[model samples]
Target: MTAKLIHGYEVVIGFETHTQLATQSKIFSRAATAFGAEPNTQACAVDLALPGTLPVMNREAVACAIKLGLALGSHIAPVSIFARKNYFYPDLPKGYQISQFEIPVVQGGEVSFFLGDEKKTVRLVRAHLEEDAGKSLHEDFIGQSGIDLNRAGTPLLEIVTEPDIRSSEEAVAYAKELHKIVTWIGICDGNMQEGSFRCDANVSVRKPGQPLGTRREIKNLNSFKFMQQAIDYEIRWQIEQIEDGHAIQQATVLFDPDTGETRAMRTKEDAADYRYFPDPDLPPLHISEQWVQEERAQMAELPRTMAARFVADYGLPEYDATTLTQSKAMAAYFEAAAKACGQAKLASNWIMGEVSRRLNMAETGIEQAPVTAAQLATLIGRIADGTISNNAAKQVFDALWTGESNDVDAVIESKGLKQMNDSGALEKIIDEVIAANPDNVAQFRAGKDKAFNALVGQIMKASKGKANPTQVNELLRAKLAG
Candidate 1:
């Protein structure tokens, strides 16, 4: 079912994700699959379809496909055929591409993610193994175009999904979840800028309960930000066209990041237009159940499974669990900190809030975080034991980040951030504040919560912001009650 209607139109979206498999060599040849090499250096005889070259299946590519199928809970076809999708392009050296059709390696599955707190699942149609087409590089500086065939035969798994996504947000969430899965399982690097992963969105609109409208496919949405913008623009554009009495046309369009608009590239073609047929040069691909089981045995715990464990073992909220398991490195960091401090919720909060904030500012990944998990756990321990306040912890964190001190206690001592937990000292200060603020105390007794808060602020300020907040609240409530 559709998630919701946007502006009285039911938006339907499907995705086609091209995830380049992480193999050392091209799919059917021995050429290097490394990126940023000199153009055309990676193309081999079979990749170029030289007269006598015959395609050889890459065992590693098939293993990666099986791994993805297992990760997504998709069916692994025992026997799948390879067909030639015939198309003519300057970058296509073979004039045809070898891809799976009719019977794909991975049959059906679903990718589930949270759209805010609401759970959404996008069903999968199939994920097929295919060869990537080369790039057509247009150089305005030289006033010429060149074909870089280095990418021509790189192994790719084209993942397709049902039209279950409703909004651009849902579409992007689905994409991110898929990206995480492929990378988590070591299938794809999920690098959009390098074109290791690419997305094409099919968006359409109709009245509630009406038949699906003709759709336009947006091509080469390499970034999640651009993907959402493209889909949003297309949705608005389609709605505008329909409102003006212009019918939506089924075509392929390109999103120009420069103009923040989508323009028609060409009329979209049907499957029949591709003239697909089983390639005479290649044989049907076959996979064994034993092979699938072997892959399953070696696979890492999935994000969902790890998230569930986090919820159960750590007593974390479902949302927290899901957020923590976004990447393997992040999950490891949280678990290590939680284990060290014996406080799961506090660990989650610090990692997700303070650590994440710093990481975002630095534009770095969790793997690159300067503060070690053990160091964070030590800092949290100080906060828990009333050795420092949360605000003080931030100072220590900043110090740790800048390599000023790796030791949390050393930083706390040097900065004098230790919380004022001495009951005698705090009590004397509270008494003085109470005596000096007679009117405020009277107003607080008259049921003004703000007066009580102001008194608490005075205590903190008098203590030089080192008073333990929890202790202050408890003692002040007792003093007022008496």
Candidate 2:
């Protein structure tokens, strides 16, 4: 999809994400990787790089990498090497981070998602395994900073993407799809607020047919809402700098949520500056075909695959299938409801409409929905069997949602909401409505559609809204024709 140009210049974006693996131990040590632990309690001798302590790779961390490769349809490397990414900081006890450089475990994949009904794809360069640095805390210290090494050596899969993103909206869509994929595969928990998933966006802008502009990296966007805001502000800032005759320099920048702007942090470093060298302490990692196949065999059904099944099996629209498969829980709930009620389209409509609306308003997830799938099936069944009208069914749903009643039939019975399906009984009311409203009858026969709706409304009111709307429309039209 073409991105709408901003100030006659097109936006281009790429992304790098750090996803903390779901292993219980750190990537290169036996230290616990649990969050919120006392600053140094979880940091072992290996993680702290004490003398004579050599790094030992965690088997579970490597297993997480294999699952990610299969999930993205990427190549699982038979042989990959770890390198020392040399850098210096207070929190980096080893003075370098152990990461994959020349030979990454996962290579060459694409993430696809829908942007306003148009499908957008982003190409991935690589997803390399790495170790995290500890954090520096300044809030609690005076004229100094405290270091928390609990996060150090935590396993991370650094996923990098090509610059195929065109706009902030597209970037968000791509991010969301990738997030869904990683969490769905169970490699990462995808808790952005807890720092399990973090994104760095490379944003630039240029003329429609011109070469790509120099890009700046916006670092550590933890939430999707903040991500879009940062990208947009960066796009405008870059365009303005170029308009003022300033050359766009390559650098790393930080987004300030309070200011809604990005400020330069430092110049971006090239690979040569990192002084990458293969780690001599550990041997090259090797994986056999059998290991990759084992992981694949144990994996759950992927989202896109399940969506296709939903379309073919349930005869659902592509949009409905895609939306329902956004999460595993959502998909399961929908399937249960569909199977119980025997009406796929009707179940989809209620789920996507009323169910979703209530969920959002309450700031809750589908799993927390007070109305169970079995309860929804019962309510839908009442509507299908002509035991209640749509309007009346909504009341029953509200009663069910708020715990007013546990049974669909009970709600309908107590409220006197049963539909007037008897043709003879409905016909008497239809005749009375026609006799009292002559002008509307003449207008209807004169081919005015509003007159037909007016007569239908009067019949519903006269029947105290118990009339089945579909039945009323059919019988009203038949009597008028006679």
Candidate 3:
């Protein structure tokens, strides 16, 4: 919808992002929470909801929640309590989820992110600590359903944002920015495919200055593309209902990727309806101020700050800076290459262009990069030292990828790929080219720049494309002009 129509009908979005903590054990038990395990094998007494098995809080999970709160500029609650969210599902063995209700571990935070050209900030309502539910696999071939408890009891930090988002674009941007932060901070892997991190977008459309419309929550939007699509479709659907003089109902919906639409799962349930009550087995969590301070001190530079530094310190364009700072690994690679080659722009070009292109083609990520920063820096140094032509340097990079060698000098020498920088040798090649292309030489004398270019091409070909281009140009100009 156009902004004007959207202005008449505000698009309000709130995000409930579940980020699985990077811990070795389950939140309330000693059972391993590792992914890809056999179904139901990871479940222990606590995870299986066996009676008389009390819950024990994991200190590491609480620490992770605090770290995330500090990163989001949120206040760490001095005391937070865990309550049982009662529900019945085949996947949920406990018949209730142990989660924070009115008292969250982190409260009143703000996450700053950008939306296109405009800088948008979203207020965080709270980030609560919770344990994840299990997964159900249904297939017709099996003719029966299966349950996987490997994901059950995994510690998750549920970050909730206020209804400040105005469009699907903003919602997607917020999710992406959050993903970057959590991944960079080493708190979560942010692998949407593996369900390490996921988002549910709550969408509602209202007339400007009117009371907010009844919101629909779209769940299980794991990927960023799906998040955008699901929210976009939900917003339109709500607007259609309002236009038809029907009031929108608050409900939980699921996005169908095959149909590109959201279908209602059930009516939204309020927390009181879940019969929230403190678990008598577990004690309330008390986060000391010193602990929060320590985590804040350990945080590495965030993406936005790092991107600005790339612009200010390295003199990179905004786009280049953004590209380089997208991931911690890419930024580290650029920094090492820049330090070695002593050329920030050139280092950025190689990393963003050739390195990025190759990684995308191979379906690899920066973490799985074949070329290390030191190797890339060394290769770029060869070009700077005039040891290899730019085209030849690319060949060296390819060789480096195949376990050949990263030593630029060694590769050039072993392959006999060094540029012919000797003026006399270039002059002889230019002489041979002039002797063969008398017509082109005459054309150059007639002030035809194109003819001189053609002659240069022949000289480069005669040298097997190893001639220094600058030397070829100078020698060609002198010989042909004479």
Candidate 4:
């Protein structure tokens, strides 16, 4: 694939995602990890770093990291250490964050996704375990800011990626695929609105084949839409500056959705600037090979693996197989429908086309769809076995979706949608159509395909759209030749 150039400069992007683990407690404390609590109410002694309170690592957080490592096929380090990242913020009551620097629990992995027809792979640097800082609230108070410590100490897995993304589309695709994996594996809730999954994109643009340019980190992009917007705006801004004979500066920026622009928050800090040192209270985390294997054994089948099985067992196209397995619910729905109807391709088409369209329109997931897999399969079966035409099947599908009827056959019968499959009856209709349209027959013999189509339309109209289209086409050709 050719590199995407923005104003004669190639866009380079990397992502740092903070995935909030689904653990019940904080990473280093027993504070509740639930959202929407009163400010500072959920903060425990350890979370607040009160005197005499020591940090104790949560085992579940470690397990979550291990689960992600296995899912990404990353090397799960048997031993990894935690360090203190010195920082000062209104929300940081501890005056420093506990994070990993020199050693991380989950090391190098890669996320692969498709951007248009091109396959792109974004290499991972490391996914380190860390604690979240509290949020600063300024809306409620007019003259002062408020600190909400409830989110502090929330368990997080900071997944870092190499700068492999060359465009905003690729970056969004990578973010979505990563979100699917973390949620599919049940590690995080994957709710971007509630801050359960947050992404920080580092974007830079440089002349082709030149040294990498300085990067600006866009912080806390909670929505994919905003992530793309932020990157695009940042890329344009940097290019504009460079064109004006100004150098791009490295800094942390925030995207404002209201204005669709990015503003610098602060100068970007390097790892060495963090003053990293091992945490005195917490020991290095250790995992046995047996533990890693146990995690692997209990993990659900990965999406890629399931996609391969769909291609091999169901004979679906690669794109269809990959799309069907996008979410676990959708995959199960497709499998059930395919098995019931014994028409894998038809089922795949319906699910990917009509079913997906309706679901998206209603803003609902497959699990919440009004039409059940069995019901859809029954509809497909009718169409497959000549009980209904494709158009008629859609009528039945609408009736089923709107609760007009539950039984596929009942809907077809009530709507009088059953196809006219009798050979003699269809022959009579075709004979009448051909006899009535001698001009069309003459034109058809003169090599006009439209004339042939007109004859078929006449037959369908005579039968009130009940004639099976395939049978009509076959009988018309036979009669035309005779």
User: Residue by residue across 78-175, what tens digits does model 3's lDDT show?
Assistant: 99999999989888999999999989998988876656546678899999999999999988896998888778899999999999888889888889
TM-score of 2: 0.96
TM-score of each: 0.95, 0.96, 0.78, 0.96
Go through the candidates in order and give the clash count of each: 0, 0, 0, 0
What ranges in model 1 sit over 4 Å off? 1-4, 140-143
Model 3: residue 298 alpha-carbon error in angstroms? 4.6
Candidate 2 lDDT by residue in tens digits, 1-482: 46689999999899999999999999988888878887789999999888999998898888999998888889989999999999888999999999999999999988888887777778999999999999988975467789999999999999999999999999999889889988999989999998999999999999998999999999999999999999999999999999999999999999999999999999998888899999998899998999999988999999988999999999999888988989999999999999999988899999999999999999999999999999999899888899998889899999999999899898899999999999999999999999999999999999999999999999999999989999999999999999
Give per-residue CA lDDT, model 4, range 1-482, as digits (tens). Answer: 67967779999998999999999999999889988887889999899999999999999999999999998989999999999999999999899999999999999999887776667789999999999999998875568788999998999999999999999999999999999999999999999999999999999999999999999999999999999999999999999999999998899999999999999999999988889999999999999999989988999999878988999999998888878988999999999999999999999999999999989999999999888999999999999999899999888888888888888898998889999999999999898988899999999999999999999899999999999999999989998998
Q: What is residue 277's positional error in candidate 3, in angstroms?
A: 3.3
Worst 10 residues of 3 by lDDT: 1-10
Question: Could you tell me the lDDT of residue 203 within candidate 2?
Answer: 94
lDDT measured at residue 157 in model 4 versus the true structure, 0 to 100: 99
- Scored by CA lDDT, what does every candidate get? 0.94, 0.93, 0.87, 0.93
